[model samples]
Target chain A: MSSTREIDALIDMMAKLPGLGPRSARRAVLHLIRKRALLLTPLADLMQTVAVTARECLNCGNVGTSDICDICTSEKRANGELCVVEDVADLWAMERSGVFKGRYHVLGGTLSALDAIGPQELRIPRLIDRVSTENITEVILALNATIDGQTTAHYIADQLDGQVTLTSLAQGVPIGGELDYLDDGTITAAMRARKSL
Target chain B: MSSTREIDALIDMMAKLPGLGPRSARRAVLHLIRKRALLLTPLADLMQTVAVTARECLNCGNVGTSDICDICTSEKRANGELCVVEDVADLWAMERSGVFKGRYHVLGGTLSALDAIGPQELRIPRLIDRVSTENITEVILALNATIDGQTTAHYIADQLDGQVTLTSLAQGVPIGGELDYLDDGTITAAMRARKSL
Candidate 1:
């Protein structure tokens, strides 16, 4: 029996998910139907709410529902330190550890020559501005171990040399490992053992 | 520098995401702010569109934009075979392989006695009804290899014992390995080598 167009549309959208495809999308849609009240309804409601309210923080380049993010506004997080990361996923990883007490600066992406991405494409300039304005004394580069990540780190360091203490997460993260893959404990250890760049 | 209530509320919701926490949620919100036009605007628009249009297929339980799913409505897919799976993720995995020509049936979940989930909790009864009414000649179970998955499969088998040709994906899927984790080639091989139940 052929599925309806609406179901196909949902499957098509689900197939676009990071790890799902058409078949899995179909199954997921089905599961949601079977558990309409318990799972599907809630999921749909949350998705709708997020769709309307979700926005990016203007100051920190984070995804939220307002102009400024919570971290950027929290006085308790202004401990003279700032953590820098290539992606929001990295920032999330650090937060999951519940160790760091400082603010954050999301660079959006790394500098990749092949992809024609440079400092102008990332939020490097904005990061520099945050250091002085936020009274940050130390900046932690919690980037991935990929070549582009290191390149971005060095570039940022050059821009902020002699201005603030620049450091990076120490050895613990495997080579080429993305911060999103590392467990919370490993991220914490790396953050604690960070070395000056 | 406390964030506005709106920003805080957004962060709180983001924190509930599968892999995010309060800190990361805050950072993500900030990043979206910096790239409002390029990333945030488009993302927000897509989220809103999906929220308004997304629904489930009335016949096959697939998520979509209308009452019936595309696959269920497509005349070309009216093959006599129906492949049953445990989740939407599983169905998408199968579709990604581009092998199976028949349609699908999403069971939503397994028959778990511990969780007090029974056949009624799933779409088993609807599946049986569809089999006879849709002129289905074969039913292929492509559930995971977990204990609960097997139990669910057995129950389904008993439900349609002599009504149609009952079969299952071959024993190629690793133990406890979800179909979503398997590659397209593996899914295709398993489907091609399905065995009689």
Candidate 2:
């Protein structure tokens, strides 16, 4: 009975996860009980480890296990190209294709005037600084093809207008399509056919 | 140029995420740069905090910010019914419904003979022990309808036969459909009409 309280509490918390409900949480908990070592134990261990070591890359804003992410420390990718996105999910989507050979900048979201979001609230200044300090030659505005995304892109283009080459993914990204929804082939095609903004 | 190398390394790592590709990662990185403070800075902070604090409930296998998950420690939920599931995702799905006032047991996965998984490899023993020690009156098997899921259910049922009431969610879970994919209403319906094995 005492442990049952604990179990109920666990189920309640689990129900709050993005996709689960009380029923499925109940089923899932039972399943985990039946596969403790292979799934439960390892999952628990991984969760604990990730809880303690997960972090965002200090220099580039990517999630990782270190202060300065692995990308920010590598010596093989200094190609003067910087790609942009709106969320970590989008960043993960891009990484799955394995075609881009540059660094990343996660925007977290689009500029929403209704939400009162502005450039100062974003990483616009840091981008400008990185453009100069990182000696970035080409800045690809690979944001989603939404109105806000395009607006943000135009704003950035204006800021670094004369300092560096500015380009963006061409054609494949549909109108209002978030980068996370596009397939690898489409993303690759878009990158290859990037147009100067 | 040096930072480009770092960026490339980061993109490479991003590509390894579940849904991203190189092209998208590049684009995402660029976006993050333009929205550094509004999005990137806060995201990084959150990631760092979550990375350091997320762990799993040792007793019921749910992920949380403590050694003994919040659910496990809470005293208000011991309803004598134990619902089981296959994964943390499923557990979360159940919790989202706001119903089911009992505990949970996460099995991690179904028993797969092809994968050489056995009862010992799962939390089966622990589950049986909990049934007795916790005064569990009803043990609900909410496993997926997959072949392996059914097999695991049968195996667990055999172990706990006549020890307590054993039932399963009635019908709403589609054949081979993961609980993660089911909507909350369907999960609730299934739970409300759960049938004895």
Residue A61 miss distance in model 2 (angstroms): 18
Writing each residue's lDDT as its tens digit, candidate 2 over B82-106 gives 9999877667667776577788988
Docking class of 2: incorrect
| Model 1 chain B lowest lDDT segment of ten | B1-10
Q: Please report, in order, the local distance difference test score of every candidate based on alpha carbons.
A: 0.74, 0.69
Error of 2 at A117 (Å): 16
Query: Per-candidate RMSD vs. true structure?
Result: 8.1, 10.2
Across A152-174, the per-residue lDDT of candidate 1 in tens digits comes to 88989998999999998876777
Best by lDDT: 1
| TM-scores vs. true structure, each candidate | 0.58, 0.49
Best by TM-score: 1
- What tier of docking accuracy does candidate 1 attain? incorrect
List candidate 2 stretches off by more than 4 Å: A1-197, B1-3, B173-197
Candidate 2, A80-110: lDDT as tens digits: 8888776655666676666778877766567
> B-chain TM-score, every candidate?
0.82, 0.81
